[model samples]
Target: MLRAENVTLSYGAEPVLEGASLSIEAGQFVSLVGPSGSGKSSLLRAIMGLQEISDGRIETPLQSTDIGILFQDDALLPWRTAIENVSLGLRLNGRDRGRAVAEAEAWLERLGLTGLGRRYPRELSGGQRKRVALAQVLALKPRLLLMDEPFASLDAIVRARVTQDVVNLVESEGIGVLLVTHDLEEAIALSDVVYLLSNGPHAHISQRYSVPIPRPRNLVKSRSHPTFAPLYERLWSDLSDVVDGPRRIRTAA
Candidate 1:
């Protein structure tokens, strides 16, 4: 549903991304992985129209080009309650106030934050806050979701559960996702296709691999599958080559 074709971006004379291409089809889960400074976040920014591309093209369906973004920190406003945060987008889009409240409440419930809707970000735990953040974006009902390490801050148990919730949402709601994550296991578990990017001055996608593991995948069980180790090794080997310095495989959030 969204395509970035040979996209390039620069900060003044410095190039960040070069010839980076990827696509997110309806009901697809795509992940981008790279070392720090590989322009993963920059590429996402360009796709979200938050940054200007120096070259190439981005195309999306005309009717549903609106995209929802979920950042690693969750980006919740300190003064707003959970429901308020979720309703902000709807209200800005000129939705009816009462309907916006109702829809936001429903999204809160869907994201496992039913009674917590009235709680402000500071009052909520990290996972709860992240759930609120997820609801905030999902309530927009955008055609595509751009996630930049949305689960990175959560504990392992919470991240696993949230990942499962995201998988269900993708399957049931048919939302296309292009996720940028440093967590290789998380990417392998959640993505249908994974793209590896080399580090930059001028970062570019180096390889794309299809995840053969079947859908309705139980993240824990999927890891135990015979194919999982091989896939992980291959991706590691490919990523290890381009990601150098102390950064090696550790990318910025």
Candidate 2:
């Protein structure tokens, strides 16, 4: 439902992205992975209209309200209780207070945060807070999700469980996702397709790998899939090449 075609982004005169392109359809899970400073996050910002692109274009039939973002910070309000936080968007969007609360409560329950609604963010564990944040986003019934390392801060175990929860929720809801992450294993485990970005100053998509694993995916079990290791190695090798390519050129110069 969304396409970014030959997009380019620049900060002042320094270009960060050039000819970077990708697309997403309903129920598809897509990821962008690359070295630090490669503009994976910038591409996402451009898609969201939070950052202006210098060239090319992003097209989507969905309105701004149709998109939801989850950042690594979760960005939950420190003062709002869980249910209040989840319902905030609905309330602002003109949903009736009672109806918004009811819908928010339902989303909290769906995300396994049923009894925790009354608690503040400080009262919840990391995983629980992440779920609350997710509930906050998904409660809006967004058509597309944009995640920027949303699970990166959680511990490995919590990260895995929350990742699986995300996979389950988004798949069940048929929402398309564009995730920007530095973790290749996480990318492989979660995405239908992973696009690798070349290193900046003028970064672009370097490779696209279609994940061979089937869906209703278990994050842990996906690692053991027959095709998983080989894909991981190939991605790792390609990532290394892109990271090293600049250094090699510098050395030659």
Candidate 3:
């Protein structure tokens, strides 16, 4: 549903991305994994039209208003209740207040947040807030999802649970996703395609790997698949070569 061809971006004289290309099909999940300075988030910003690309083209059937993004931080309004937060997008779209609330409640329930709708961000746990943020995005019915390490801030257990929930929900809705993450296991487990970037000052997609694993993946059990270890090792080797090298440690964007 979205394609970037030979996209380029830079800050002043230093280029962050150069000739980086990738695509996401309808209902397909793709991920970008790379060192901190490799422009993963910058690529996302470019795709979202938040940053201007210096070269090439980005083609998407969906408009900027149709894309939904979830950031590393949930970015929920502290004063809004969970349901209110979820309903914000619908409200902005001119949905009826009652209908928006009802739909938001249903989505909250779907995300395993049955009774937490009335709670404010301060009252909810970290995971619950993330779910609210997710509901907010899904409420808009985005054709493409742009996630910038949405699970990175959560604890391991919470991250795993939320990740699984995300997979189930997005698959059922047939929404395409382009995720930016440093976690190779998360990328491999959740995405159909993984694109690795070389280290910056000017990073490009150095390799692309297909995850042959089937959908509705068992978060725990899938790790034992014959292909899992080898894929992990291969990705780790490639990633480590960039991050652990003599280059300065730059966290994955």
Candidate 4:
């Protein structure tokens, strides 16, 4: 549903990404992974129209309202109850109060929040807050989801559970996702296609790997898949090269 073609992004004269391109179809989970400073998050901002692109184009048939975003921070209002937070977008978009609340309640239930909807963000655990943030986005029935390391803050076990919840929920909803994460395992476990970006000042998509592991994936069990380790190693090697290429060149010189 979304395509970015040979896109370029910059801050002042310094380019963060150049000639980077990726696409996501309906119900597809695509991931972008690379070392730190590879402009992964900047690419997301470019897609969201939050950052202006200096070259090429991003084409999406859906409007801005059809996109949902989840960041590392939950970004939920502390004072708002879980249900209130989830329903806020709908109400802002002119949905009736009752309908919004009902929809929010349903989404919370889907994400396993259920009776906890009355709790405020502070009262909820980190994982719970992330789920609420997720429900808030999903409640909008967005066609595209842009996630920037949304689960990074959670502990490993919680991250796995929450990641599973995300996978199940998005697949069921047929929402296309473009996730930006440093976690290669998470990418392999969740994505159908994983695109690797080169280390920046002019980062670009260096390689795209189509995951051979079948789904509906069990995040933990999938790691044991025969194809998983090989793919992970290849990705790891590629990322390592991108990260260390300059140093290697200097050493050779």
lDDT of 2 by residue, 1-253 (tens): 9998989899989889998788998999999999999899888877878999999989999999999999889889989999999999999889999999999999999888879999999999999999999999998889999999998889999988888989998989999999999999999999999999998989889999999899889888999999999999999999999999878889999
Per-residue lDDT tens digits for candidate 4, residues 81-132, read: 9999999999998899999999999989988888999999999999999999
Off by over 4 Å in 1: 62-65, 244-253
Query: Candidate 1's residue-wise lDDT over 31-147, tens digit each?
Result: 999988889998988888899999999988734436888888999999989989999989998899899999999999998888998889999999889888888888888778999
- Highest TM-score against the true fold, candidate: 4
Cα lDDT for residue 7, model 2? Answer: 92
Q: What is the alpha-carbon lDDT for the whole of candidate 1?
A: 0.87
Order of candidate numbers by TM-score, starting with the best: 4, 2, 3, 1
- Runs with alpha carbons beyond 4 Å of true place in candidate 3: 244-253
**Steric clash count of candidate 4:** 0
Q: How high is the lDDT of residue 111 in model 3?
A: 90
| Total backbone collisions, model 1 | 0
C-alpha TM-score for every candidate: 0.93, 0.96, 0.94, 0.97
TM-score of 2: 0.96
lDDT of each model, Cα atoms only?
A: 0.87, 0.92, 0.90, 0.92
lDDT of 3 by residue, 20-139 (tens): 989999999999999899999999988988999888899988987789999999999998899999998898899999999999999999899999999999999999899999999988
Local error of candidate 2 at 4, Å?
A: 0.5
| TM-score (C-alpha) between model 4 and the true structure | 0.97
